[model samples]
Target: MRPTLLAVSHGTSDATGASAIAELVALVDRALPDVDVQAAFVDVQQPDAADAVPAIEGPVVIVPLLLSSGFHVHHDLHGIAAKKTDAVVADPLGPDPRLADVLAERLAAVPGDGQPAASTSPVILAVAGSRDPRSLTDAEGMAHLLEQRLGRPIELAYLAARKPDLRTTLTAHPDAPIATYLLARGFFFDLATRLAPGRALTLPLLDNGPVPSALVDLIVDRYEAAEANVI
Candidate 1:
């Protein structure tokens, strides 16, 4: 039998956020029709990842739907895999150039004449900040990738839990548009919109629009890589 692909996300309370993640899982499920794709969360929803892992019967590849390495990746997910036989944790989805391509596309498509053109306006890659240093590095790496894609310097800012918050970044570059680095619409996305009133804020990585093919491919790559390492 094929090893299970356990797609884990950070979880969100917002209904749209939840739906987008569900859609992402559905996309991945379709991508690998033979594999059993399962969904679980680290917080703000159920079934919790801790419970989901133990219930699975065979080899499992725990692929984080998250964007970077942080407390959940370094502690929570890895800890669960350490205790479970035939289970291996995969790298998070981000810091990849493909994701930078998505961000660039989103920035280009920002509508309304009220917002500055993506070409003219400075772009700030706004992330859901984490206290973990590793998480911060991943966020910066993503910013660099986006910078390369846009062919312009990209500023990095946090929504919470770290320095250089969104408002501060805006205060410095008042006309900058935020390229939302979040997976979906959630508290931090909401906060980003609220903080930047009347400013051009790009949609989250996963939105009401069709799931990015690049993202779907990235998840499958993570699963295949981790499953290979499972022994």
Candidate 2:
């Protein structure tokens, strides 16, 4: 039997954010019909990993739907996997070039200051910051990928829990567009909108329109790579 793909996320209370994440899981389910795909949350939602992991029958691959490694991935998910017999945790979905492509598309879709964001124009990559140092490193790595993709300088800013917050970054750049580095709409995205008042801000990676193919592929790759070592 195929191992269960336990797609875990940092759950959100926002209805749209919840739906967006569910849709991504559904997309992955369709992509791998033979494998069982289950959704679970680390916080703020039901069917959590603690509950879901024990219920699966076969080997499991726990794939974090988060953008970076942090408290949730290290303490929360790993702790759960450590207790299981044939479960493995996969890497977070970010710090990849495909995500940079999605970020670039989002920037292109929105005009900056009545004009397109120029390739040379400085852009801020706004991430939902974390206190963990590894999370910070991953955020910076993502910024570098996006910078190379956009052919522009990228400034890494946090929404909360870190310095150089979004509001402060906006003040510093004044005219640079903010590329939303979040996976979906949630408290952080709402906070970003409230802070940016009249500025260019791109939508999160997964939006209401449709799930990005890159995201689905990335998740599947994570599961497959980890599944290989599940014995």
Candidate 3:
């Protein structure tokens, strides 16, 4: 039997957040119709990896729907995979050049009055900050890739737990747009928007609508990488 793809996320209570994750999983399922794709969470939701892993009958791949390698990836998902012999954990979805393409697309497509032009105004990459050094490094790596793709400098800011908060970044630039480094819409993105208000143009990640093609490809790539070790 083909390995079952277990897509896990840091769950959220927000309806929009839940739906966005579901949609992304659905896209993965649709892309590979023969494969079984399941959704689980690390927290704040049901059917976490601990519960979901035991129920699966064959080889499994746990792909974290996270932007960076944080506690959830290092501790939670790794802990769950350690208990199961047939399960393999995939890397988090960030620090990839394809994601930089996604961020550039989002920045270019931002509509309305305050949208910043790629050639002129500065862009800030805003992420849900982490205390983990790996997570911070991953975010910076992504920022570097995005900067290369856009042919401009991209500043890094955090919504929490890091230096140069969104407000400070905004205050300094005063006219730059914030390219959200989030996987979905939730409290973090909400707080980011509120911080800058009208002054910053915030772009959505995967929530509130359809999943992007680049993200879908990235998900498939991670799953394939893990599946290679299934035997």
Candidate 4:
């Protein structure tokens, strides 16, 4: 039987946060209309892991809609994985090429006023907590992708762990600040917007907003591209 795709997030106590996650879930649902897709929060929401995991009718591919590997991705997800006797744990959405394009597109979203990208803006690839080393790789990839797409430079910043905090990263750069988020917790991630006086904007955790249809296409492509692998 075909597996069910679970788009999981850290889940927040705020009502708005839950709404945002739900919005992303809807986007993924619309993206892969043919597949059996559902949403679950590792915390702060109903249907705990025990409730969510065992109910799967077939194999489940848990696609964490998160940016980097953190406690949630590392410990929580791993715990869930240990219990998933019937499901397949897909890799966290870090380290994916489409992510770069999505982030580049997010940077492109700032109201640029028709100015040349190279002349007008620089971006901070803002990520959530970052203990894992792979976060750096993902950040670096996003930076390169943004540069290639916009003909400008972009730096990396972490909201929690790692060096170069958001403020410091912005100060290190000479160009006006723009933050492109690469994380699952959208509301928690969006705070970076306030930190930037220039223009702090974040891409939606998923969907890519105006380009929902395009993101849906990418999801289809990813599904088609999915091969036999254990993560």
Candidate 5:
């Protein structure tokens, strides 16, 4: 049986956030190529987890497009999918090889195209914070990736409730003239939050490009493994 895909997101009360989650379904369609794809929300939205039950006649793969393996990724997604508990849940996309490529691409595609002049000093990698050790470790792992791909030292910055705050990140590369954020799911930075002001240098998240391609491969690998087990 062809495994079905149900991507559950931490749904938001805001329409825009909800729309982005919906867009992810289309993204998976492009990645998986001809597989049935469904979308669900863990909260504050319709077509909830129960809605995915009838969408698949075969095994199902539950993917969480969240950044960290926090409460939502670890517990909430599981709780909602309890009825379909047999489904296989893929790990969150963090510190994956593909993400490294995405970060490099984001930096290279900067308005100045990564010209030496664009970076007057070093680079700062601003990320959404997490209390999870896995996420923090993943953030630390980014240093190796950024170093190899970018051929420059990159420092990690926390957007909220975590260590190595933006100040620490800024301090890491004491004289960097240009700072950029490598993130998923939002427009470079979440405009809805005070975390980011409208910086002209800021660009969109890992959009349709090498990043998406890498993201898809990682997701598909997870699916292939799950499919072998009929999950």
Candidate 6:
């Protein structure tokens, strides 16, 4: 029998954020009809990993819908996987070039500020920062990927717990646009928008409904990779 793909995320209380996550899971379910897909969260939502995993009868793969291998991935999800012999955990869904493509697409979709040239409008890749160095590294990797795609430099700013906070970054580049490095709408995304008001161009991670094909593909890839080791 095919193993179930347990797509876990750092849950949010924001209704829009919740809806976005559900849409993402639905997209993954559609992509892999043969394999069962389930959604769980690490916090702030019901049916967390622990509650969701026990119900599955056969092998399971826990794919974190997170951008980095931070506390939730290492401790929360790992703790859940440890209790199940047939389960394996997959890495977070970011630091991928495809995500950069999504960022670029979001940037392009936003109405231009009537700037003479794209090069004139700088970008700040705003993320919910982590104290973990590895997490920071992953965010930096994403910034680099986005920079390559946009053919310009992108500054990395955090919503919390890191240097170069959003306000500071915005102050530094008054006219720059903020490309949110977030998966869905939440407190951080809201804060980013408030920080830059008119200049912040937000991208809905999974919440845009009808989930992006690229994101679905990435989630499936992670599930398949973990499933391969489910023995």
Question: Which segments of model 1 are wrong by more than 4 Å?
Answer: 112-121
What is the TM-score of candidate 5? 0.75
TM-score of each predicted structure versus truth: 0.96, 0.97, 0.93, 0.79, 0.75, 0.94
Report the C-alpha lDDT of model 4 over 55-92, residue by residue, as the tens digit: 88766777665655566666776678678666555556
- Model 2, C-alpha of 109: deviation from truth (Å): 1.1
Q: Which candidate leads the pack in TM-score? A: 2
CA lDDT of each prediction against the hidden true structure: 0.91, 0.92, 0.85, 0.63, 0.60, 0.85
- What TM value does model 1 have? 0.96
Between candidates 3 and 4, the TM-score winner? 3
Give residue 54's lDDT in candidate 2 (0 to 100). Answer: 85
Off by over 4 Å in 5: 12-21, 30-34, 43-45, 50-58, 81-85, 112-120, 171-188, 191-202, 207-211
Could you give the candidate ranking by TM-score, starting with the highest?
Answer: 2, 1, 6, 3, 4, 5
Q: Which is better, 1 or 2, measured by TM-score?
A: 2
User: Where in model 4 is the C-alpha error above 4 Å?
Assistant: 14-17, 31-34, 117-121, 183-187, 197-211, 217-231
Q: Once model 5 is optimally superposed onto the true structure by TM-score, how far is the C-alpha of residue 12 displaced, in angstroms?
A: 4.9
Worst 10 residues of 5 by lDDT: 191-200
As a whole number from 0 to 100, the lDDT of residue 19 in candidate 1 is 98
Supply the TM-score for candidate 3. 0.93
Q: Write the per-residue lDDT of candidate 2 for residues 1-231, one digit (tens) a residue.
A: 889999999999999999999999999999999999999999999998999998888799999999998999999999999889899999999899999999988988886433644757789999998999999999999999988887789988899899899888888999898999999999899999999987889999987888999999999999998998897
Q: Model 4 reaches what TM-score against the true structure?
A: 0.79
Decide which is better by lDDT, 4 or 5: 4
Clashing pairs in 5: none
RMSD of each candidate? 1.7, 1.3, 1.9, 3.4, 3.9, 1.6
Query: Native-vs-model 5 lDDT?
Result: 0.60
